[model samples]
Target: MFNIDKNKVKHANLFAAGLALGTVGLKVLTSKDAKKVYANVVAAGIRAKDSIMQTAEKVQASSGSILADAQEINEKRRQDEALFEEEESDEK
Candidate 1:
C-alpha cells in the first residue's frame, strides 16, 4: 500500500476540490436547463462573430477605395509637377 505523505496536504486538498467540481460539472451538464443555456451562449457567440466579420468587411472595402483614391491623387500630382517643370524649361 502507498503511504500518505503529510507534505502533500495542499495538493490533496486541490485534488479533492477538482473531483468535487468534476462531479458537479457532470450534473450541471446533464441538466436540460444547463444545456439550453450552453446552446444559447454558443449561438450568441456565433452571432457576435458574424457581426464582427461584417463590420470588418465593410472597413476593408472602404479602405480599398480610399487607397485607390490616394494613388490617383499622387499620380495627378506627379503629372502636374512634370508639366510645371516643362513650362519652366520653356520659359528659360
Candidate 2:
C-alpha cells in the first residue's frame, strides 16, 4: 500500500498537462510521415492475408485426400473382420 498527501496533487496535474502538450506536438510534426508508414503496413497485411488463404486451401486439399484414404482402409478392415468371423462360425 502507498500513501500520498492531498497537497501533492499539483504534481499530478502538471504531469497530465505535459503529456497532452507532447501528444499535440507529435501529431502536428508526424501526421504525414505516419500516413506513409501506415499505408505500407496495410499493404503488407493484405499480402500476408492472401498467402494465408492459399495455404489454407492447400491444407484443405491434403486433408481431404487423407480422409479418403482412411475411409478406404477402414472399409477393407471391416470386410476382413467379417470374413474372419464367418470362417470361425463354420468351424464351430
Index of the highest-TM-score prediction = 1
My TM-score estimates for the predictions, one after another, are 0.75, 0.71
Instruction: Give the per-residue lDDT of model 2 (tens digit) for 1-92.
Output: 77977667888988899999999988976899888988999999999999999999999999999999999999999999999999999999
Tens-place lDDT per residue, model 1, 13-92, is: 99999999999999999899998999999999999999999999999999999999999999999999999999999999
| lDDT score, candidate 2, position 72 | 100
TM-score of 2: 0.71
Native-referenced Cα lDDT, model 1: 0.97
RMSD of each: 4.0, 6.3
> Pairs clashing in candidate 2?
none
lDDT values for all models = 0.97, 0.94
Instruction: Output the lDDT of residue 82, model 1.
Output: 100
Give per-residue lDDT, candidate 2, residue 66: 100
